[model samples]
Target: MSGGLVALLDDIATLAKVTASSIDDVAANAVKASSKAVGVVIDDTAVTPQYVSGLSPSRELPIIGKIARGSLINKLFIILPIALLLTWLAPHFLPFLLVVGGAYLCFEGGEKVLEKLGWLPGHHEDHEEAGATSAEELEKSIVSSATRTDLILSAEIMLVSMAGLSNEHGVMRVAVLIGVAFFMTFFVYGLVALLVKADDVGLRLARGALEPEDNRPGPVDNIGRTIVRVMPHVFSVIGVVGTVAMLWVGGHLVIANLAEVGVPVFHHVLEAAEHAVSGAGGFVTWLVETLLSGVFGVILGAVIAWLVVGASALVRRVRARA
Candidate 1:
């Protein structure tokens, strides 16, 4: 009996060690994968706020919450299993899917640019249009739009995570993919919630400072007001940054994908430029490559958008006559 008990104890200790190692592996891989997807994450953060832009203060948080929930569902319930299957069954298909995702990012970025430049109609005019709607309707609209956007961003994130995983057992792959899905959904939506509520927080602080008890104008009030005043500009900056991020990330993905598929011209050009600059010109080289990539992405995006838009219009005309 004593000998048997000793053997069991030793077995339990070995199992514990195995479990601990598995946990560590999952964490390390999740972190690495999340970092690889940072560009897409930045664009996700930048793009999300626009969905809540026209919403009233009271509806903002709730709408963000709804979208966050949807994003969670998307990652865990939808994207994870699909990602694992693709990784296991059809790894070669990933680059093609990523290229499709890149095209989508380009299309979205190009559309935003066209809207800002007054070339696209239906630019969101919040005060006039959204003001007429009920708060509940507005919230639903915002949440739906946000969730749709999240689906695409979530797809990109999943693909990045899938690419980062080692060719391990199916169970290990599933564990890492699910772990990353949860981490990214929480990270992205939590940040979005904070950003959406920042203006309200500023307003509350301003009101508190302006209370009659304080009497004289205080620095707090001034700062609060300043935040309120600058919030729109902040959102504008985020919009521009998001568009630029989309283009940059999309272009980078395309370049990387092309290199993966055996075309190395762009990669070689970038490397030669980096070498020519040597130590002193590193930053300049990076900037030039990034700018060129962005320009290429934008041109490709615009052409695609034009084709899509024109095709849709023709279809609509045919339908109308029919």
Candidate 2:
């Protein structure tokens, strides 16, 4: 009886050790997977703040919170199930879906470029144009647009994460994917929340400095004013970076998917460029590839934009005639 009890205790210890190892493995894999999607995550973070632009300072965090919740829902409920289904039933379709999403990113990024160049109509609908009769309506519109955009970005992040964990098993894979999703949403939105409120924080500090010891501007007051002044430029830089990232990632997707589908010429060209630039430096090779990808993305995006715009015009004409 004593020996049997000792054996049972040993077995329990063994099981506990195995469980602990499994949890550690899951965490390591999730971090690895999440790192693979860093570029998309950066794009997600940069793009989100634009949605809250021109909104009341008080509403910024709330709007960000709502979008983060929607992003969570998109990853866990919509993207996860669809990704698993496709992985199981029609794995080939995953690349196609990725390409489609890439094209969308390209279209959006390219349209912004054209708008800046005065070649395309502006897409941004500011608060006045919204004709929002109530705060709720305006918030709803902003949240809806943000959520829609978040869905695509979140899908890309999840798909990228899954691709890295292709070798992982059933329950482990799901757990890691969920971990990545939650971690990314929280990180991105949390950073965005801080960014959007930075100006407000600065303003408060500036006021506080003035309220205290001396009514005259001090070093602290100067620092606070500097922050408030710097935020707009910071946001503009973020916007530009986000647009460029979208273009690069979109084009990289196209090139990669094309290679997977057996057209390898572009990949070969990039490889050759890497080889040629090896004598120079790794950074040069990366820069060459990135520039090439951005160019491809811009061209693809322009073509798609033309088709979509033409189609819309045709539909408008048809409705007018009817």
Whose TM-score is greatest here?
2
Error of 2 at 234 (Å): 1.2
Of candidate 2, the 10-residue stretch with the lowest lDDT total is 123-132
Model 1 misplacement above 4 A: 1-18, 54-56, 125-138, 166-169, 211-214, 262-265, 278-288
In the range 156-274, model 2's lDDT, one tens digit per residue, is 88887887786886899999999998889999999999989999988987887874555688778788899999998987887788788888988887777778767788878878877
lDDT (tens digit, per residue) of candidate 1 on 246-292 = 88877777777777777778778767766777677768878877887
Root-mean-square deviation of Cα positions for candidate 2 versus the true structure, in angstroms: 2.6
**How well does candidate 1 score on lDDT at residue 248?**
80
Which regions in candidate 2 have their CA more than 4 angstroms from the true location? 1-16, 127-132, 211-214
Estimated TM-score per prediction?
0.83, 0.88
| lDDT for position 27 in model 2 | 84
